[model samples]
Target: MGELMGRAVQRVSHEHREMAAERLRAAAGDGLISIDELDRRLGTAFLAVTFADLDAVTVDLPPAPLEVVAAAASRRVLRLAVSNGSVSRFGEWEVPGEIELQLEHATSTLDFRVSEVPATGVHINVQAFRSRVRLLVLPGTYVDLGSLGRHRSTVADRHGRAGSSRELHAVRLTGDIRGGSLRVLRRPYQLF
Candidate 1:
C-alpha cells in the first residue's frame, strides 16, 4: 500500500456544499450574476468534491460584508442531527441566523410563531432522507423557497409568495430532502 496518492484534499461536507449553493442563489437574486452564470456555478457546486473545487465556483463574487464577517465570528450557527420519528423547534426558542439539520426517516416541525427570529433572516441548510419537514410561519414574514436542491421531493407551500415586502426573506430554506415532502403553513394572525 505504498503507492502514494496525490496531495490529500479535505473533502467538503454536505453543509459546506449547501452553503455555497445558497450563496450562489443569493448572488443571482441580488443581480450580482447572470442566470446563466448561476446555472453554470450551481452545476459545478453540485459536482464539487474537494474544498478547492467548491471554492472555485464562488471565487469571483465579492466577499461577504464586514458586519456579516463579525456575526460569523460570533458563531451564530445551529446544527441538529436526528434519526427516526419526529423533531420540533418551537415555544420561544433561540433562533440563530444559520442552521444546519440532518434528518433521517423523520418528521420535522419548525414553528416560528412565538420566537424572536433574526430580522436579517435565517439561512437553513438541511440534509434529509425519507423525511417530512413542516415550517410554521406568520404573516409579513418573507419566505424564500427557491433554493438549490438535488433530491426527489415535493413541496406544498401554502404561505405562497411574499407580497409587496421590501425585505428579502425572513426564512430561506436551502439544501436537499430526498424522497419526502416540505410543507409550509402560515399561522393565523393573533392579536393576543
Candidate 2:
C-alpha cells in the first residue's frame, strides 16, 4: 500500500510538471528556449518527489508579448475652437501668430488676428451654442481670455498648463455681449 501511494504521487507530480512546461513553451516564442533547458526542467519535474520541488521547477517563466498594437498617435501641438448656433455662444476673438487654430463644426463666425507668423496669444468670443464646444491645446503654449462668462465651460489638461509669458498665446469668448462663458489655457516656457 505504501509503495502504491508513492507511485500515485509521483504520477501526479510528473503530469503537473508536463503541463507547466507546455505553458512555458506557449509563453516564450519559438527558439527562445534551448532544448537542453527544456529537457532538464522536464526531467527535474518528472523526478520531483515533493510539491515544493514541482513548484520550484515551474518558477521563472517569462510572460507573452501583446499581439495587437494601437494605431492612433498623439500630436505635439494642436489648437481648436468650436461654437454652436446661438447669439450668446461665441463673438469676436484674437490669436497670436505663433500658434495655429483649427475650427470644428462651429455655427458662429470667428474673427481672428495674429500679429506675427507664430502667434504669442489668442482671443475668442463664444456667441452661440446649441451644443457644448470642445478645444484641445498643446504644450509650451499660453492661452488667455480677458473674461469668461456663463454657459458652463470645462477645460481639461492631460499634462498641465504652461507658465507665464510677456505676451499671450490664445483667447476666446462665447455667448452674447452681456451673458455667457469664457475659458483660457496657457503654457509658458519662460516667465519674465
Candidate 3:
C-alpha cells in the first residue's frame, strides 16, 4: 500500500510488517526468490517505518487472491471459555485468526510455539475477572498490548525483542482484563 488520494503515505504497524514478511517468506519457499533476496526483504520488512517501506518489501511479488484474503478474514473466531478450571493448548494444534477469551476464576494457556499461524496474524479479545491468561508464543512473534484494558490486573510480557523474524506473525491483545493477570511467555527455542 502507498499514498492514497495524493495524501501522505500511511505509517506501518507491526501487523503490516508481519504480513509483508510472510509474503516474502512464502515467495522464497515457492522458489520465486533466493535466500539472499528473502533475507534482504525480511530485513526491510522488519525495519519498515511507513507503509511505503513495507510495500517495497513485496513489491516484486504477486498480490494475494482476493477470494483467499476474504476467506481468511471470514474465518470464524475461536472462543475459549472457562469458569473454574483450566484449559491448555500446546504441542501441535491449529491456531485460529482470532480468539475471544472468556474467563472467570479460571486459567488458560494458549501455546503458539508449534502451530500454523495465519499470515494475516491473530487478534485476542479478552474478557476476564479473577482469572489468569497465559500466552506462550514463539520468540519472534510480535505481541501488541496497546488495546488491552486492565484493572487490578498485570500483564507480564517476556518476549519483546527489538526486531522480528520473517516466519513469525503478529498478535494483538485487546478488551478488558480485570482483577487478574495476563502473562506472555516466549519460548526460547521453537519446537517446529
Candidate 4:
C-alpha cells in the first residue's frame, strides 16, 4: 500500500493526465476559465509526468474531497467466474476498481445506473466462451474499449460526453470472447 502510494505520487499515466484535462474542461464549462486558458492547461496536462504536474492543471479550481480521491485510488478488483448460468448485478452494488468475469455458457448483466462507482474508475474484464454479457452505464459514464479478441460486440454511444465535462469515474472493458456476445449500453441517470 505504501509502495503503491509512493509510485502514484511519482509517475502519472496518460489516463491520469487525461483526467486532469477533463477537469480543466469541466472548469471551463463552469465558467472558471477562458477558452484560451483551457487549451493551455490541456496541453500541459497531456505532457504531465507526475501527480503534482497533473494537480497543477486544476489547482485553481475547487478541490475535490480528499476522501473521494483516496477511495478512488485505493479500490480493489472484483472477480466473478461462472459457467452454465446467469449472473446479474444492479441496484446500489459497490463497484470495484476492476471486475474480472470469466464465463462459460453463461449470461451476465451489470447495470451501473443504480450502482456505486468509486472515485477512480471501474474496469470490466470479460473472458467468455459460448456466453453473453451486457453492461449498462449511466449517461455521464465514460467507456473505453481496450483489447478485444473475437466474438460479436456492440457499444452504443461509443464516444460519450467527450470534452463536455469531467468524468470522475469510468468503466473500461477488455478481454477475449469466443462464440459469445457482449453489449455496452448507455442509459440516462434515473431519479427513481
Tens digits of lDDT, candidate 3, 138-190:
77678888779989999888657554322236777889999999998987645
Better of 2 and 3 by TM-score: 3
Clashes per candidate, residues 3 or more apart or on different chains: 0, 54, 0, 0
Cα error, candidate 4, residue 143 (Å): 0.8
Global fold similarity of model 1 (TM-score): 0.57
The parts of candidate 2 lying over 4 Å away from their true place are 1-120, 153-168, 172-192
Number of the candidate with higher TM-score, 1 or 4:
1
lDDT of 3: 0.76
Higher-ranked by TM-score: 2 or 4: 4
Per-residue lDDT for 119 in model 2? 25
Candidate 2 Cα deviation (angstroms), residue 69: 47
lDDT of each: 0.74, 0.39, 0.76, 0.73
Q: Top model by TM-score, which number?
A: 3
- For model 2, how does the per-residue alpha-carbon lDDT over 1-192 read when each residue is reduced to its tens digit? 987556545534333444455544553446656777777776776777665566566556653222210000011123444543322222223222222232333332222321121222334444333333333344544444334444344433345444553344343333332222223222322323
Error of 1 at 123 (Å): 0.6
lDDT (Cα, tens digit) per residue for candidate 1, span 34-149 = 99999999999988888778778988887654344335322578888789978789766777777887899998888887876654567788898999888888866777777737
Write model 4 residue lDDT over 1-192, tens digit each, in one string. Answer: 987567557966544564576667767888999999999999889988888777778877986554445344444667898999988897767677678899999999988887666566676788999888888887667776655676664444464655311245777667888888877778765666
* Superposition error at 158 for model 3 (Å): 3.1
